[model samples]
Target: MYVAVKGGEAAIDNAHRLLADRRRGDRDVPALGLDQIVEQLALAVDRVMAEGSLYDRELAALAIRQARGDMIEAIFLVRAYRTTLPRFGYARPADTGAMLIERRVSATYKDLPGGQLLGPTFDYTHRLLDPQLAGDAPVAAPATREADTRAMPRVSEILTREGLIEGDGALPDDREPGDITREAPEFPMERDLRLQSLARGDEGFLLALAYSTQRGYARSHPFVGEIRIGELDIELDVPELPFPVPLGRIRVTECQMVNQFQGSAKAPPQFTRGYGLVFGQSERKAMAMALCDRALRAGEFGEDVTAPAQDEEFVIAHADNVQATGFVEHLKLPHYVDFQAELDLVRRMRAEAEAHTATPVKVAGKAAE
Candidate 1:
């Protein structure tokens, strides 16, 4: 049992005031609005929404403001706020195939049905800051065109048609998904839990885990089969309604990685897949997620599970940045009593050793004459 300490209320209040002042900054400058954050700094909001497990961009933008642009802290705020909202009903799973793709690219095939569309990307742009961006000059609008209406066939489906890739026939979408927030993950978990963990996992941690696999530790030899960034419609099935009603649409990023699988005694050689889906245009996060997803599937694929990324317990357990940071940061809190007890024990041990050393000569002989 720990006793509560009194005082520091004034200091805590002052600290909060100081934080607000720092967040606002210069009085002459215009205050940064939530809308501006949602519009201009959209990537940051997307990250918060992805990790926070909340879909509302407006709330995510507000959280980013309240957290003063600390993404992790904003994520924490969003997660906490999300729990308070009532669950009306589950929405139907998004149809990725029908997504209105704005950006689509493939690394596996030289040519796809819809030749790679580099819609909007920083891939070719030189990393230079334009001086005009600093001023209030009117920014030019980008050239717009009608999106390609042709159906973008999935790269995985194409590979599977040739029997080069394995397929999961008739997926059980109605099956209950494991909620990481509600329940703790167990070993040998279902695929849903693994996907859930990676979906909300810290980007940096996932990136490192993905990089480890590429560095030859549990290497899966993966290729970006396809990556699609687009807005997907979400619908909910109302029991009274004849058909599912459209709720709205959200921007998402999806990555499908093709991996080589060597034939084993029981199974024949084929290509497998690793999938990643995030809330927005997070290509790097999605790519890293796909690689980690593959690495975590070593057990199911008959590959060696020696690496940290391959260990289910290690990866899923530490994937949550909130849990990891909370446990680690708890050290900053008062531990004086515990430290005192340790100090007492250490001092006693040292004194006993010193006393034993000082009295040692009398034991061997009569005053060592």
Candidate 2:
């Protein structure tokens, strides 16, 4: 059959136009609004915001729509947009102790000072899909009696109160943070690199890695000290008070993992920490992240580490999806040029092999014998 293969520029331009048309959909149908996406696909927005490292709901909603609900694409979009934003002052660390908590749970304790509040979760729900969701649903409110905002101490606080558990404050300050982005990771990294890996690491990958550790990769037994969802105060550096000034509030999920620790000669036994903080109600990711964080701290604990999650170099190296995707997709851009070079090399090697076969080598000792 006769065929024509030509016009690369026109083909690419046509493809781009078609993509725009498909993304926009029919002319009769109105473009999906940001509010609609935000209201309907909140969880997607949450994931985008968490992964994108940005907190603007509107921006996140826009990214979700623009990326067509592909979370990684949404994250890429947000990150790209984020780079264009003006550099602002960094916010000081948010305080969890003073958080206006919505959901608080502790696996370590049955009952604690601050009672567990199961705010919004799918944990105990039956997996069966409901047909009633087709209609507009009524907004459900918490029971009036259960809405009290009483100040409550953490479950771990009781352990500290009785001197039963050793906190992170007990750890020696000899170890320093390793910067993963600025420098390449080396063996025997510090806690900072591990935390950074867990922070940006793929949720599923980190979960599996964390699971492997619990499934007997690492010897430490991790107890979820506290899983808290709340509004934490964002403070900014102000020269006036010599302290961080409270700027605003942002909702976050903070998971503090308390792992068993044995005392060494230099330091007394205490509960070493693995902390995970994420935007929104991503408790599972936070918990998984915390576990992975603890696993990665194996080197710091002076233990024989053999877990995939514990390899700081490997874990941190593969954690960022942005880096991973860029390297993986760059292969799609014009490798025919490289293929031609490789083809030339292979042809030359074949020609040399044919020449060598045609010219037989001398059999010296055997012929003489």
| Candidate number achieving the greatest TM-score relative to the actual structure | 1
Clashes of each: 0, 0
Taken over the whole model, the C-alpha lDDT of each candidate is 0.86, 0.77
Reference-based TM-score of each model: 0.92, 0.84
lDDT of 1 by residue, 236-337 (tens): 988889999999899999999998875668767898878899988888889888998888878777787889988888888888898888899899998889
- Superposition error at 36 for model 1 (Å): 0.7
**What lDDT is obtained when candidate 1 is compared to the true structure?**
0.86
**Candidate 2 lDDT, tens digit per residue, 1-369?**
434545589879998888778878789978899998877777777777887878888899998777767788888898899778785566765678898988898888877776777877787999889888977788688565646566777666777776667654333467545555457867665566666656766777777878888898876589998999989889898666787787788888889888887578976677767788888778888998888887777776788878787877777777777777889988997767679789899868766766788674455543586
Can you tell me which runs of candidate 1 are displaced by over 4 Å? 1-4, 145-147, 168-174, 359-369
How close to the true structure is residue 219 of candidate 1, measured as C-alpha lDDT? 78
